[model samples]
Target: MNELLTKLSECIEFGKINMASPYPPNMKGQEGADEITRKALEEGVNPQDILSLGLMPGMERIGVKFRENKVFVPQVLMSAKAMSTAMLHLKPHFLSGAAKQKGTFIIGTVLGDLHDIGKNLVGMMVEGNGYKVIDLGTDVNSEKFIDAAKENPDAVIGLSALLTTTMVNMEKIARDIKEAVPGTLVTIGGAPVNNDFCARIGADHYSPDPQGVVEFLNTKFA
Candidate 1:
């Protein structure tokens, strides 16, 4: 069972979605995350154990690789795809209340920023790490964020921006959230953002990558 879990993690980390998948060339034609996850459940492995031992660890490894530049966007996207495939099995357990999530994460790309790849990546990573992610998609304004926060009071918020001009909207949204919900934790990210800008705007955190956001959430919620 442990061996199956380990193999599942490897499949997800390396982007092997299934037996016929040719990705990562070396892993082609082997049982991938899709097959291995089903096998684990059939073998009577606990869903929680499979999630903690298989999927989450694999995502954490790929996330660290991304942070260190050992991997790039395409690789991470593939990994996220594999992870999402595995999550299909786990989602039922989560919804049935047999599994509990760590927390809630509300995320969006700030207004005027139609870019969603970065925001989507962060949301996927956070969700893979056991948080329920409420994605607001791209071009979200302060009021939408505020409304989501009101709907999920304990949720942490994340903001994404891809352009220098659009980063100003992130600042405005952050300010609005903070003003309306005094203790809300707001995190900012994207190509044009930095720790300095986050501080200047009174946001709670700044991360350069999806992994950085995961780490910040872990630390704060730990």
Candidate 2:
């Protein structure tokens, strides 16, 4: 069972989606995350174990590589794709309450900022680490974020902005979310934002990369 879980982790780490996927040349034809996860479930592997052991570790590895510039967006996206393939099998268990999620995360690109690559990467990374991600997409407004926070009271909000012009929107959205739903945590990120901006805006956390976001969430909900 442990061996099976390790193999599943490798499949994610290398971006092996399925038996027929040809992204990584050396891993061709081997059982990928899609097949392995389904098989693990059939063979009585616990769904939660698959998430904590198989999926999270693989995502962590890729995220670190990305932070160090050892891997680029394509590799990270492929790893996320592989992890998502495995997630489809586990999602039913999650819905049935047989498996547990760490917490809920509501994410969006701040208003007037139509960028989604950073937002999407963070959402995928957060979801891969076992949080339920509610992606509000680009050009999201303060009211939309506040509403989502109200619906999921315990959820953490992540605001992303790639433009300096739109960063002011993030500050307002974070303040609005907190005022509308007291005690909700807000984490901010993007090219123009930093820890100082986070502190200035009264947001809870600031991470430079997806791994930093994942690590922050883990610390909060652990």
TM-score of each: 0.96, 0.98
| Candidate-wise lDDT, in order | 0.90, 0.93
Residue-level lDDT of model 1, residues 74-170, one tens digit each, is 9988888888898888889889987777889999999998999989989988987778899999999999999999999978999999999998888
Please list the residue runs of candidate 1 whose C-alpha ends up more than 4 Å from where it truly belongs after superposition. none
Q: How many residue pairs clash in each candidate?
A: 0, 0
TM for candidate 2 is 0.98
- Candidate 2 residue pairs that clash: none
Per-residue lDDT for 50 in model 1? Answer: 85
